[model samples]
Target: MLLAASTQRTIGLVILAIVVLGGIVYIYFNIRSARNEVGSEIELASNRKPYLSDEDLEGKKLDLALGSSLVLLTIVAITLPLYWLGEPGRHEGRDLDTWRISTNRGEEIYLEGAQCVNCHGPEGAGGVVNTAITSSSGEFVAQVNWKAPALNTLMSRHTEDEILHVLNYGRNGVMPAWGSGGGGPLTDQQLEEIIFYLRSVQISEDEIRSQVDSGVEAGAKALILETSDEAWAVEVRAAEAAQADAAMAVRLLGRADFDFECSDDASECLALDEANARLTAANEAAVEPLDAAVSTWFDQVSAAKATADALVIEADPSLADEGNEDDLRAAALEILSTLDAFEGQEAYLQWGEILFSNTAAAGTYSCARCHTYGWSFDGASDYVLEENGRDGPIPELADGYVTAGGFFGPNLTGGSTLSQFETAIGQSAFITRGQAIGQTYGRGGSGGNGQMPGFGALTEANPVGPGMGPGSGIVFEYPALLTDEQIDAIVAFERTL
Candidate 1:
């Protein structure tokens, strides 16, 4: 049994008390004995009155003293060994306590000191940052609400060291460098504390799969809903065109044009008047219909998301209530297995496409962020087209990407994955376990830099698991980033890409 700190302290106090009381009793007896025997007043203290001769004194007296010393030595030998035996456990407890304290401090900083919860969401559920995008030469582009990735599943894709590196140097210019190395406020230890907090928030394998499935389902339904409102689409287009015209008009006016209350025959005054009228008319026209369309669209999107969320819950209500993940995973997998096409190229392929392009969890469930150029800040974000003209840095893409023609990762266009894996199973496996630095994967796929993240339960080198909470200890489970069926769907989509 582990000795609690309280119990240890109590034991120490008892031992000290015993030592103090024993000293007190010994002193009391010594004082009483020091009164000098009544018969020794006239004698040479006790020395003259001693009855034991040299022979008797050398016999039992010496033996008794020697025996007492031996007994005390035996106690010392026994107690020393026993104390040593408990030392290791005490040290382990101390270590555990230290980590626990560090985790608590880190959490405090995340929630309060650093206030990371503002953009990253409570418990690292993921959220958004409202900011403006800009051009290379410092021109304003558009207002954007960028999605911040969830830290709940972060360890599965990266190790503590890697996560620390990100904290030190930041990523994408969106997350500021928090560590001193990157010239921000935090020290290396503070960054490490953040990692410790992140470890604790990571969701379990079942929860990870559930989150992934939820996002996938949401994406799938959203894509179908993408074209459901043709009338709304038309209204949206009109608003966009009006917005562009307004922007162009605003651009046409020069600073000098507004300097004077224009002369009646001035060309500059006429041009300014025309531009202002165009801008006013455009705003009035675009605002109403677009607002109505936006409202209707949000309602539909919410309903779609709700429908997707209910799928797994409806599949196994008993499992859901009991929180039996193993069974729930089976039920989820059962649902997933039936998603493949009963008709043409398979319905799973649609799910796969959506999953690949999913924007949920800051595209944690999506591949486009890494595989498609400009996907991060492009029309993937909510933009104010009115503020931006047709010349916005990232316009709404026609079909959203060359559908993974590839950017950061190797292009899988033209049946590239087919040649690399030769079978869907092999590709699925590769995506599941992911790549390690200096470790190769597939046929001739060079693993230089080893950035391919695992989609399944990762262990060993990866931070893995929801490493947080009381009594969970430090050994974190490798998080399963995606289910087997989900990986298969993505693989199926990749083969086509």
Candidate 2:
């Protein structure tokens, strides 16, 4: 328990008062007794009288002085141990205070100084930033909102040194250099503080799993809509239009009325409430048709899996209810294979392609952000330009993407990936466990400078601390960003490209 500053000050003052009062009383009595002495400003007279004889001074008075010294010694002995016992706790609390202060300062830099929140969102829940794409010759492409990945689970995916490396040297042109080492403004210490702030905002493991699942589900739904019958697609589009309209109505009302949530029950507040209600209903309506389409797609996938049980790990039927993720993933991969997903066939390529360039998490879980040029700026979507009445802005690629013909990362088109790995499993493994800063990979694939990120669980040694040996450091297992089945699909798509 910590005392308030005022309370502590009051206590300190009371102790000071007691000590000063005691000293004043002692001096007053001593001075008052001095008047009775025969000497008055005459040092010779007092010196002439010899000190008290041994008989008078060396008995009770001497014993009392010795006893007082012994008592003080005892107090010191007791107090020193007590103070020593509390020292560790005191220092721990101080360290905690220092960490809190540093974290707050880092948060300030992230928001105001660095303005990372402009793209990464408040508290790192993820957001989008408007950026213009450019062709090789510097011709302007459409202005698009690029998805910035969430930092709440960053610690789960990256080690401290790895994150610091990125901070010092920003990711693929999207994220700019922040540290002075990369010719940016912030100092190394300040970047470390930003990382400290990131640590403070990390979400739970369950939250990470849910986020990954949601992304996959969204991509799966998009694939379903793309392949669905015309009636199904029309219904989905109509519901989406209605949802968008309701949301727009609410926004327009909110802009006019202002602060309806905290205001009194006025006319505008009632109108805002009605708009919100309509939005909620429309949102549900929109979800219904999309969910139906996705359900049908899942049913087809399930039927395929049932027929191809022997192709993969055919576990006991009873184990199906055990919720074993590995088993389920294995089954899913087998089903995809049965649908000819791994053979670079177009029939299954659409689903794999959707997974490869998934926009969920701003394509954080997908390969496109690193592998495809201008992917972040909606390079393929001309509607964004045409919708805004800006015409004739040529895309760098006449086609949507060069697939895995990489930009920030290496190109994987024209059977490069196939040549890199002898088998699909090896390629999948390499993609799942990304290259470390100086770790080697593949045939002639020298350890990259932290280029590709591991989408699956990755184990790396903790940076050796002072007095620690190479293999003695702690090992950290970064959480998987994508599931095995999802990763396999992306790998399959790359093979096709």
Candidate 3:
């Protein structure tokens, strides 16, 4: 009975399978007919090619599947290593904290612990890299010099904002902009972190002040030695005497006695000749004293210069050290401050003023041109006064304005007013040369844009401005223009503005 039941079950299963197979066959035939019609329509296209046979299609599909799998495997292999390498866990070399921070790309963009040590010397002291730098005095003085300014003093000398500006804009063409303007290779957060790091390492103000005092003392001693140099004094006196003698001789020669034969009257000529003879005698007498004075002065200047050179050599190493940078800067400030103590010492003011005024005059406009009393001409100002006498319009001063070119000039009323006498005689030399007189002074010509001409050279726009001679429209350029000394003096006075 069991064998008979098994046979019956098998027969039923076979019948069910047959029905399913028949349905599948019907559906496959109908799909094939539809595909044929579609294939024919597609083949009518101008660019259509012959369709692949079943065997060809199967081989192509096999190849595609293998290629796709290989590609996917390759991508996975590449990404896995990259992800692993970038992971913080894989970083093993430096100060973990610094490494984490630097690699973070979130807070700051700096090298991690060991990396920092590699470029920046230990203790965050700066190291030399091949970089072009500009001097604070606006001269292209040095390039890729191994002498790197220490970074430790940056905090004491500059505010955070100012520091950011310097980092972003760079200095003296030597320092490359390292912030946003420098392509923002790092995020803003990274810059701030670096700033924080710098702040953490800054020397105290007291230390800076002390160093400055020492520098000033050294400078003062040098100055005294210069002033007391008898030999230099003698040379200067001699030069002065010679110059005076030459002038007097020329004057005497100009008299009636020296008149040209073109003169119409012999009596006038005779009278002139007599006058000339008397003048010549007087000049000869004056020559001796003038020569003596000039000789003495030159000798004094030479001796003083030598003393100054020696003092500078001694002071330079001390001033340049990261430990003493504050003091050096302070010394410079102190020197500037002393200008007020020596009120009648026009020379000091003249020197300072030339640096200040030329920085502004080298550009198109200055802080004073717009802000008036609100801004100081020596690049110092506290308030931005309004056009209405209280609050001023927003200043459009860009980084370039402060260091290269500006639309306005600075005001110097906060300190001391420059006497016209000093301006006339002190800054004359600088004015005549048309050279930008300070580290921040701009180039003279309008930078490439024809609409604006440079202030240094003769331009159609500025025919009579500083450095330019009288306009061509004038009958004759002044035969003998103001001397450079006179121009420098004028610039000095302008600084007192």
Candidate 4:
């Protein structure tokens, strides 16, 4: 009965319980009646010998036992196969429940356990990450705001495994690794759940493209407003006139000369002070027209950007049914193929630079961060350190110090890349799969552990940490970080450098 309740064997147990209770009650009444019968028989046969056959009672008992065994065997034969047949459905239901629970747990970890939402935003839209800087001994140094990337479109940029690698090992000591391999805190199961949650938040490619185009259009409109307006020209001319009048006034009063000694005589000092006051007034007046022009331009640009963003939202293609998977793939491919139009153009090289330095998205997940000397960014200077293991007052780059020269990673300038890679394809491939631990890369470059992250696919497959449980040794396939055209553009830019 205890086993039945524990295992939830309800139907059979309920029947058995009823049968056992009935037998106990019947035996209680039967024993009481037998005791009365035996008492009467003993009184009647007080002084007489009884005659009876014991074989008849034994025959009746045997017959009853045989009948009960036949009934039990019949029931078992009918129920066993039915129980076996129901197992497949039960297994499927259990799996579904497990996945549902995992997804929920992942969302919780993203929001609360990991506090990823603080940097990535509530919807993973990205935001500023403000952290206090400290010395090795935990001295307060500085505070900075780092731009965190939008995870809503993360899948479009990187694969599951690539994202996992980042989660495990971290980046440049800014993003702390969360897996055990890098001495992080999260278990392997938690990492997998986070991936599941990310999959649910992905936006369509069409929407992404539309938003990008809107940004470009808004920038163009702002540029045109700055240069092409007649009102702006008038304001600039007025500002120039006022500024000249102020300069002339100062000059006539001799306030422009540094050695014009007026401290000894009271009258000379008073006159000098008056002239300085007039010059200050004129300078203040000169700024009004310029400030108005600048403010107007900013307002117009902001309004234009808002309108463009709204239009993009309204024109999103994902709202409508786009046919089969093949059709969607073809449409996406066509849009991606247009990136090649910038090939061999000057703009291509400039685009590569933007990709290398831009920290608005994905933080500073760019090549320059690893390649350039002290090239860490926090919404301020791109290069934070003047030299290794020291805080800075950075020197001027008067000698045109190579920006992409070696720092944490190797130097890409000085024709070294050209020597390593003979063709564009070879360079692109090397950029795709960065240096893994114990693995040699382009030309004679030695392996430097898993320091370099691959932009194409993950090179390290087996799980790195001990926290990974059963079936953790399998490889995680990730999506490429940069598109083929983007990689090609970077290759072109690096070759020129």
* CA lDDT of every candidate: 0.65, 0.66, 0.39, 0.57
Task: Rank the models by lDDT, top first.
Answer: 2, 1, 4, 3
lDDT for model 2 comes to 0.66
Local accuracy of candidate 2 as per-residue lDDT tens digits, 1-497: 13343455465556556655775797699768764335434344654866676568768998899789867865765565455545555755775786787789899999999999999999998888877666566776556677787787676666667787888888756788898988989998788778768877877667767776676578777666555666656555556555555544554565555563434445544555555565556556657787876676666544544444434444456435556655655554534533353332343445567767767656666677778876766766644544334555344555666777788788988767767876555677887777777888777787767667777775656433321227545464557777766677666667656
Error of 2 at 420 (Å): 1.8
C-alpha lDDT (0 to 100) for residue 229 of candidate 1: 52
What local lDDT does model 3 show for residue 42? 32
**C-alpha-based local distance difference test score of model 4:** 0.57
Which lDDT tens digits does candidate 1 get at residues 1-497? 24454466567556656665775797699778875334423334654656675568668998799779867965775565457556656776776687787788889989998888987899998887776766667776677666777878887876565566667777666777888987889987777778778877888877876777667656654453354355544444455555555444544453325554445576655555665666566556555555555455445534433343357677556766666765555444333334342233344566677778777777776777677755665553323443343443364344456777776677877778878885566777788867666678888988554466777876543232233334534455676787776676677678766
How would you order the candidates by TM-score, starting with the best?
2, 1, 4, 3
Question: Which of 3 and 4 is ahead in lDDT?
Answer: 4
Which has the greatest lDDT? 2
lDDT of 2 at 332: 47
lDDT of 3: 0.39
Q: Write the per-residue lDDT of candidate 3 for residues 69-103, one digit (tens) a residue.
A: 86786566456544544343333233346534533
Model 3 TM? 0.27
Error of 3 at 52 (Å): 89
C-alpha RMSD for every candidate? 10.6, 12.1, 27.8, 14.0
Minimal lDDT window, size 10, model 2:
460-469
lDDT of 1 at 235: 46
Across residues 464-483, which tens digit of lDDT does each residue of candidate 4 receive? Answer: 32223345454545455565
Candidate 3 all-Cα RMSD: 27.8
